[model samples]
Target: MTSVPMIDEILAEFLQSGLGIHVGTRNEQLLPAGCRATAIKVEDDGRHVVVFVPKSAAPAVFENLRTNGRIAVSMARPADDRAAQVKGLMMFSWDANPDEEALARAQWAGFLAQLDGIGLPGIATSSWRVFPCRAVRVKVTAVFNQTPGPDAGAALP
Candidate 1:
């Protein structure tokens, strides 16, 4: 018999539950530019690659990503089942173009508004942009349990 690593196990659970949050941060400042997104998909080859849609929330979500160079994310699992835990990781921006993608999604207006609160300072407030999601390799840093109880037992695969 063989055993699958916890990362592999968690990824399986993530696929079952198609919802998660994609977080991005600044490289220099290291300040968290809060951004929420839906787990669109995940690809695991050598490393895990998680794709998300930041549906018209904040432009900084994408801008900060450009300046910062990387991002992180957390995804929730089933409510009752406690077999798995929330997955978190710092994702590197391999290739991304906000302007091009934003045009496609048509959520440019909404994303710009969200960035206003962030106060990019020197950065100018631009129209909504769609980040068509150029995939990146995500190194799974940690996986921790949300609740600890008798229910914290193995779940069905």
Candidate 2:
């Protein structure tokens, strides 16, 4: 697939729609690893994104990024199953600042609200955590429609 260097308005909106984000990567041996991301931000240039994952939740995810630089981010609205997947290469990562930590808190709150609206209780999501995180930056290579349908997996133009 030809790589699109920028994200458009529609896709950008969808990506920030208070959906819970999940990130995945594979090590040199192609072993898969993944974990939930607390928050995400699309850069102004539309080609880069920063995802905040719990500082200690999944060490393997960080290792995979260092080993291969590849990442796949999947996000979906639980209510309707609308979804998208972003494929990219890791650009850099750093410990999130206090302000970024606040952003993560807000993002998780929104996610919890969404769950409540969908009739899910907060207790069921108690295991989820967000804070003291490292922001993984990715330079987008491609995006795909993952919304369960005939057009699922179709690359976004």
Candidate 3:
């Protein structure tokens, strides 16, 4: 099998920094499902991204990933609105590991802190649970610049 292309340093850092992150998947019937990811872990030199989604809020997304591998994830910086979207194929879905669980909690906290730092109210407290999560690993197949401007939505090389 051909190896996946690695995400560049800038994009990798953006993903790992707990910015405005959302992950989406479609069921076999093409019904869409999405949720805000608690954290995103870049592994294997950025060829793989594992997204942590709450079981409470997105059980349908988890089930969709199981039935169909297609996935789309978007991340943006709240400060600048710079963003990117990745479209990929899910390689695996499983329970979050111990370390992953911890990281997700930390990231989620940091995300809230960032919002507060910018004078925005954080998400509802009840929406921030870290346990009972599913980790969906995706092999990125395409990257696009979602930032507004002349090249908005253009596929990245």
Best by the TM-score measure: 2
| Candidate 2 positional error at 61, Å | 1.0
User: What CA root-mean-square deviation does each model show from the true structure?
Assistant: 10.0, 2.8, 2.3
What digit string (tens of lDDT, one per residue) describes model 1 on residues 1-157?
4434435645554443533344655546676676655343344431354444444657666676656446555444333323333333445543345553543233333333334435543232333222445443455444444335755433323
- Tens digits of per-residue lDDT, candidate 3, 3-107, equal 656687777877778677888888877889888877888885668888887777667887787777888989877767788888899998788888889998887
Superpose all Cα atoms of candidate 3 onto the true structure and report the RMSD in Å to 1 decimal: 2.3
lDDT (C-alpha, whole model) for all candidates: 0.45, 0.84, 0.80
lDDT head-to-head 1 vs 3, winner: 3
Which residue pairs come into collision in candidate 3?
Answer: none
Q: State the lDDT of candidate 2 residue by residue for 1-157, as single tens digits.
A: 6545577877887787778799999999999999888888888778898988788767888999988989999988877889999999999899999898887778777777888988887743666556678998999988888999999999986
How many pairs collide in each candidate, listed in order?
7, 0, 0
Best by lDDT: 2
Tell how far residue 119 is off in model 3, in angstroms: 1.8
Candidate 1 lDDT at 13 equals 45
